[model samples]
Target: MGLDPQSRVLIVDDFELMRTMLKRALGAFGFTNFTEAADSNVADQLMVEATVTRRPFSLVFLDWNLPGSTGYDLLCKWRGNPRLAELAIIMVTSESDREKVQAALKAGANDYICKPISIDKLKEKLEAVGLGKVRSA
Candidate 1:
């Protein structure tokens, strides 16, 4: 299903600037709801809370390297959990190695985007994950 503008998005990154940039980019793409977490612990907490509240996030932009835990670890954890098995995740990181990309995908990430993300690339990845922009009527 295509993502609605109102879809909830979670951005898990250690850099505040990156999170802000992502939020701005996603906003331009028509998404209105966003939550940012600086590390994996907070991201996991937020995800669980959202799920428990019955308002699970529609998408998650996860950084591969975090302060405490890696995004790959989190992705594996979530993928193993049935409650989060269906959550759409995109790895947003600077790691562009072929093996790393393959590993993330194998771990259940819907897509992967390298750092210095361009608007067009971001749009393409979003669309690939069924989160394409929703045009206003």
Candidate 2:
């Protein structure tokens, strides 16, 4: 289903159920190496504290809504940094705002997907972000 175990991915969502859902969906999509953070603050901390020992998340499925800041804000924060410039981020949220999508792309989101994501669509999204072969259903 996936390419390797060392391909770390991060899911950032403030809501517990949403995070759980994403984790489950990604697992179903054959991504075992994954982690989660509740909000942007925690996500930032996780990125900052990361060392060379552990691989930085190559793929990030970020939630558009968060407690302290919107996902758009987080994208700006992450994208502003040179270290995370090449990171591939996919904004996964319920909000279908076109303006938000435009901003995220400008701010460095590689792609955007709305919530209630299906397994096949998620796999395709991942493939677009540079991952395993995406099988059509």
**Which 10 consecutive residues of model 1 have the lowest summed lDDT?**
128-137
Candidate 1 lDDT, tens digit per residue, 52-75? 999989899999999888999999
**What shift in Å separates residue 25 of candidate 1 from its native position after superposition?**
0.5
TM for candidate 2 is: 0.86
Best by lDDT: 1
Model 2 pairs whose backbones collide: none
Q: Give a tens-digit lDDT track for model 2, residues 59-120.
A: 78889988898788888888888887667899988888889888888888999998788877
Q: Which residue runs of candidate 2 sit more than 4 Å off their true CA positions?
A: 1-5, 51-54, 132-137
Each candidate: what lDDT? 0.89, 0.78
